[model samples]
Target: MKALLMLLPLTLASCMAGPDAATRAATAPQADAAVTISSTTLSRQHWQLRDAVDGSNRRLDALLGLPDKPLQLDFSADRISVSNACNRISGSYRIVEGHLVTTQLLQTRMACADPTLTQRDTTITTVLQGGPTLILSSAGHTPLLTLADANGRTLTFAGMPAADAHPGDDGDTAPQQP
Candidate 1:
């Protein structure tokens, strides 16, 4: 009975030391699994911000812009564009090794009269300037784009169908990026 008690503690200690072999294997790609994501994959999709939270997981609805308008992110061949209630923001962007690398964002000079709108611009800049990890998941009906920024904020965006995203578009015309 004493030997069994001693072994129980040892087993628990080993489990607590770190992840088990199975856990490590699950995190890594298997022989047949392909994991590389091409930057162009995002170019065809339109994304709208659905949730924003800081490191503490506090809801930052202020970054959401006005209730009537959505804060949108559009990916182009070599640019990342952000459209909000107040300004049009764009920057050169690249998805390097699963991280979002970008030049400093360039936004229009228009001054927003609304305080929340102004704050939204600043908040978006904060989360995007630092290289963030980009994760795209298509498990749900609508695809999801998650950005985990260096400031520890997680921004979750829901994918919109290109056709649905630009309802007014004639098939021959495409939206221009900032």
Candidate 2:
């Protein structure tokens, strides 16, 4: 009877010793540098920007002073769209090897005395020049964006709120209760 009791605990412990199902699922192949981001779901994946730091200098952050806007990145086969923050910029893009190159970037002509937007535009252009093999991560709880290199070196990026384009009085009041 004592041996039976001990054997019951031993069997239960052995069953629990194996890995959980979640751990085993992540054993899939890692994304390679050459993986092309083509589909809409892949393009709309949330990307929080990380500050691009070079040595001890913060060039992009110094220029734009962090993003005050929420932006959406919508990419297709040959073009990329950036909406929100009072600007809807679209342009053609090409991937060379694993790098992303953008050209003919045209944005809405709404005038803003703030120089930050221009600086941000420059920052985005420069980062994309490093190719499309960029790594992205969440920036805390903010909708911010972060970009990194193949070797895990982070580049400069920012997240901003999309422009207020609601049909009614904009996003001013809370939703009415049911």
Highest lDDT model number: 1
Model 2 residue 109 CA deviation in Å = 2.6
- The residue-by-residue lDDT of candidate 2 on 1-178, one tens digit each, is 9999989988987777655555666785365454333323124333334455644454545443545453346565578776543456778886555456778678787765556656555555555555545333334634333444443444544433323322223222433212
Off by over 4 Å in 1: 1-36, 164-178
On TM-score, the leading prediction is 1
Q: How high is the CA lDDT of each candidate model? A: 0.75, 0.50
Q: For candidate 1, lDDT tens digit of each residue in 1-178?
A: 9999989988998888667776887896443234344445566567788888999999887877575677788887689898874788899988887888889899998988888778778877777888888877654466678888977798888877665244223332323443
Displacement of the residue 47 alpha carbon in candidate 1, Å: 0.9
